[model samples]
Target chain A: MPDATEGSATRREELLAIAAGLFAEKGFKNTTVRDIADASGILSGSLYHHFDSKESMVDEILRTFQEELFGQYDAILASDAGPLDQLEQAVVVSFEAIDKHRDEVAIFQNEAAHLLTFERFGYLAERNEQSRDVWLTLLRNGIEAGVLRDDLDVELTYRFIRDTVWVAVSWYRPGGRRTHTEIARQYLSILLEGIHCA
Target chain B: MPDATEGSATRREELLAIAAGLFAEKGFKNTTVRDIADASGILSGSLYHHFDSKESMVDEILRTFQEELFGQYDAILASDAGPLDQLEQAVVVSFEAIDKHRDEVAIFQNEAAHLLTFERFGYLAERNEQSRDVWLTLLRNGIEAGVLRDDLDVELTYRFIRDTVWVAVSWYRPGGRRTHTEIARQYLSILLEGIHCA
Candidate 1:
């Protein structure tokens, strides 16, 4: 049996997941604490015991997801793989995150801009820069290594790849016909070679 | 010096532009005709003088934008350019539209899913299919021409390119230091050869 603090933490995690689903389906501004409470079948008072406010719950949610995501990115960056290999690993890992954390990804993508205005969510911007740095580092290394094309524009190229990979969260469903690995393979194929029929 | 009907049409255009900006900013479901009229500094009654309702205004805005955009697409499709050149032309034309019709593009990007529930906006889905066909045709032609890599997954490749190109509307500003053509050139370089230095 779980102790009181453990049970409380478990309950808190469960409630946050429910709130995230609601926030993702309905815009964060449109979703109320009452809606989340109602969805969780708990009184608003019970929710408050777990979270001081909705903002805190969302803050925790986004922070927790980013922590895990950036940890993976940090590992990829630290790996001794060649620059091109590291870039490929990064893309694959990103698709895997979308598959494994679709709801959290959706909520963050939809809400980050609106949420980041508050002082509590300043880390979102930092994570954005961190993500850019990870990609930019890999790209610059690839250029120096000659594995990637010399003529590519690093900043615009980063945005293209970043946007292309993350926007899939809007439509990608886990356990669908294509697994994350399959999607990553196709994406990398198109990225490496122009889609023309040589 | 404007005739009454011409003046009315000009007023209608201005109102539609205002409505598009609001719809893009606040979302269509959250925006009301009253909000639009208020933003335009006119009474709701005067708004109706130009537009029957907010629905009519949105319909007209979307219809006109789509007509013009599709006309350009059709011209590109029917042109005598090779597959690779056609692909480049299509990308340039798309960025041009993003530059010239930012508001309409924003509205379509943000509201197409929500708006498609109504009968009047069914063409949004059709337009999506039409867009897929346009890219697929170009991709297939490229394959037959032996200019592109044959191992690519054309459908996934099309989605990748489409998402990368269209999502720029979210962040792109027309008067930014980089012109749309420069952005297009940067994108073209990455799309063709990728971002490795060697």
Candidate 2:
């Protein structure tokens, strides 16, 4: 209840988390500010005291998640590791994001197109292009280093990897039988070695 | 348009195509019956004379597409080709569906969850389960034939294949730089053999 305190800041983060779950489960357009408030066991007026609108809550949710994610990607790309190692690390980091920030990932996957229409959320489009660049860079680096097949269609390869990895949010449960790391390992296995018996 | 004639049937097919495009682009809920009529250059009443509601158009659209798609899958399964060839053929057929019936595939991908809640669209859920079964059958058969790697996690492998193949519809444009067959061939190479330089 105190303003500018640690407890108040924690409360703000908790509220954003609840809003994200709603935005992910219900389409962002279908989820009203009241729904977020109701899910948080707070009133609309109280929710407004923390966020001016549901738009502000979503903006904060997506931006904060992306900042943390892209930072990790930057570190991986900047690391002294080999290109193949860097690519593996990037895949691991992506699955880790799915595990740690499932709701945020889901919201971004489902609502990005709708949200990107507004001027404020234009960065979402840029983030998409940036993601493409990250994958392309890793693939190209691997090829140049003789780690990946030179005959690869890097563009299509990037699309396949992006679609397979991110779309897992639809079926990947946090507490599923296989851990996210296991899933990533298996995907990497298939990505690196042919599935056929060699 | 003539009633009870070949022209009537052809006209009906034309109307359904227009409705599928709208439902795919604008979303099923966001698109109105009148919008289909407007896009078809006909009055709403004339459109109704051909179809009862937007629901009927979408139902026909999905059912027709699935019938053709599943029929091709059935033929593939029954063919005398080896398990590996069968699996490859299935991938080729799927890309062909995305190329030929892009709107139907997109509509199914985007609207299946919403439409599945309705009583009449229960088949959509069954079709999803059936599609999973088809892939599982193909994969399990491959392993039994000693073609696929035995250590491979078949279930996880199925998901990776399903997610990667169908999601291409989002970016796989018809008559683009790559034909559907070329895309399928390249994907098969990557799926069968890892992208790593050997």
Could you give the TM-score of chain B for each candidate, in order? Answer: 0.92, 0.93
lDDT of 1: 0.83
Question: For all the predictions, what are the DockQ values?
Answer: 0.51, 0.72
Candidate 2 CAPRI grade = medium
Q: Each model's C-alpha lDDT?
A: 0.83, 0.90
lDDT of 2 at A148: 96
Using lDDT as the measure, the top candidate is 2
In the range A1-198, model 1's lDDT, one tens digit per residue, is: 555357455766888889988877676766788899999998878888888888898888888899999999999999999888999999999999899888788778766766677788899999999999999999888878778886766778888888899988877778887899999988887677655432
Measured with C-alpha atoms, the lDDT of residue A122 in candidate 1 is: 90
Q: Which regions of candidate 2 deviate over 4 angstroms?
A: A1-9, A42-49, B1-9, B42-53
Off by over 4 Å in 1: A1-9, A30-38, A42-49, A52-54, B1-9, B29-38, B43-57, B118-120, B196-198
Per-residue C-alpha lDDT of model 1 across residues B1-198, encoded as one tens digit per residue: 545356455666778889988887776666788899899998778887887778787788788999998888899999999989998999999999999999888788766766787898999899989999988998888878887777777778788888888888878898997899999878876677645332
Candidate 2 lDDT over B1-198, as tens digits, reads 466356445888888888999887767877877898899998788887988787888999999899999999999999999999999999999999999999999899777866887899999999999999999999999999999998989889999999899889889998789999999999999999999877
